[model samples]
Target: MTSTNDSNKAAPRKSGPSRRGAMKTIAGAAAALVAAPYIRPASAAPTALRALMWEAYAVRDVIGAFEEKHKVKFAPTFFDGNSEAYNKLRVGGTKDFDLVQADGFWPSLYFREKLIRDMDYAKIPGTANYFPAFKPDAFPLLKDETSGVFFGVPFCWGSYGITYNVGEVPVEKAKSLELLFSPDYSGRLATNARFEENIALAGIMVAHRMGTIDKPRPDGKSFNPYKLTDEELDGVEKLLIEQKPLLLTRYQDAATLEQLLVSGAIVAAPEFAQVYRLMLEKKAKGELDITVDHTLKPKEGGLGWVDTWLISSGVTDAEKADICHAFIDTMIKPETMVQIGKASGCSTTIDIRLLSSAEDQVLYLMNRTDELRGMYMFDQPSSTEKWERVWSRVQAA
Candidate 1:
């Protein structure tokens, strides 16, 4: 569901209005940031491009450049989680949106449900710029298994791993998921509010703790974090209930998580890559007395995802589809990728070739796939209802 990046120093901030500043300007005029559109010249009243994606895509640095280049306005509908985005497209039928973003396995589901259309890679020259690890073949879910048509273009990726205050939590202890459960760290921990990821992570921890990670479930199927048996889920539920009191809060947004870490409200949590990046930026700006870093590989593999851009099936107009392709290409451009990185604290999908700064390289895990190995990449849970029930009960408890 998330990935992490940690660095002692942050890359130099580029010259321009920061995303926060831009959002504030828009927010001052509008009641909702989600409905806010990129302010374009009054003389140029062209149709606005609509996107349903993460909050990152709504940032001015990510959307404004494309709007300027294509001479179009952008209206981004921000969703906190992938399922929330999928449900919106599924119900609204993409007529209101031209482009949609989903992570990991959702592309296949979208293709299967006819919610998204296959991409014309030739139209998206940016795909050619992707790193070797991100090539189409490496991601089976992005393509139709039978037709072999790719449905999405990846834009950013990282791990949902153990993030801790550098000096407060030693590296040796931080490298294991078990540390979160340790009493020593009790009352100094936190986690995301997403049910599926928390449940999946609990399943993963259970599997590893039982030394049954490589074994099959009672159903004789291979052990999958997302497909844990009810018995296994019971363990997960119990574990979460125990961890509930330990947490400072079940944070629901990146901003809250960033503030919690910077303020030292909590020592550590399983977090996305951008939180660490943002913390490093804060530290670089002398906003904190302590630094934040995350483990690349926790003993019990971390949760990870690669989010991609997809053209919705409702884009029936030829010109609209062309614009969609162009938008995808522009987003993946090396320069734009870095710009989005600055605003989103995420690494671009293409090769790390665009990053020259040592700090940037360290934050993006520059050209290395080793950290990705053994990670339980996010996937559709076998039983969403069950996972949701467990998570709700844990929260209430």
Candidate 2:
């Protein structure tokens, strides 16, 4: 995600400029209302509701109809990264914002720290329409085991995989992370600037080499790529050091990566689905002639994330709480998800019903649930400070 603070951020839409980029309007307020069971028309809803979320969710199309329907103002602040949003809430306290959006594992941290409130699944009835994979049983971190309550609701998700220019890299080669490190693609390759993902990507190969990629952690859960042991961390650092010189650049923004891909300066990189979509947009405009495709089921399995909406513990008023639930419910509605999916082109919505066309499903990998099952969801490492030091050393190396 590009920093909201950057001056060179992507240009916004003329209709409604967001904090970072164009804010496309979401259609079908009537459809959303029809699907939403918890929402009740308000004669005098709260004057304003505050949110701290990704820039994508702050657009008028997403909240405009809800605002118009309930007669409430939507006040949102955007963050480029989850840690930024989490730290802001920690410093400012939950009272500063009514609702917050976080990625896969942060909600668990919020729950552990009591930064967010447990929400009743009954209030957000639209969740019932979500794909079965999104249920609490599949992602236990978002739900409390004892209370059977949810700390957050997932809105959009996608995987971080090897994105390659199909014209240059063959499909079979692109199906593995090994392509990124190939000597032929060395100077023609790039990687994400974020170290955590880099670590995970490298760790996957290292774990596999050590024949421990499938081994469960002490908790008996799936193997955690982020929570590397000292030996694994050393292996990851060595892998990154070896990978450092074989790059055109380490990109921090999607625009830079897109330009590199379109210009053919780089043949491939580890990137999110959104970057590939942006490249497609460029392709549509006759900006590039090359075909592009991302590895959906990389040999190491891709690193993925689900961004979710969580209400702050500070929202004590029943009326305000209900409004937050309504907002979440509106976001998960099939019609709303479709519009959001179209506008973003990167993040996949949680509802499979919105994907009626086989083309849409295949293009977005919406029908590939088994592949998603093989993915490693992004999460906080057991020792973030340790990871940071390792990352710093790799960069300095």
Best by TM-score: 1
Worst 10 residues of 1 by lDDT: 1-10
151-199 per-residue lDDT for model 1 (tens digits): 8998888788888999889889998888788778778898888888889
Candidate 1 residue spans exceeding 4 A from truth:
1-46, 218-222
Q: lDDT tens digits, residues 351-380, model 2?
A: 654455665676666766546566888877
Q: Local distance difference test, per candidate?
A: 0.81, 0.80
TM-score of each: 0.84, 0.84
Name the Cα RMSD for model 2.
16.4
TM-score of 2: 0.84
Model 2 whole-model lDDT (C-alpha atoms): 0.80
Best by lDDT: 1
Each prediction's RMSD over C-alphas, in Å, is: 18.4, 16.4
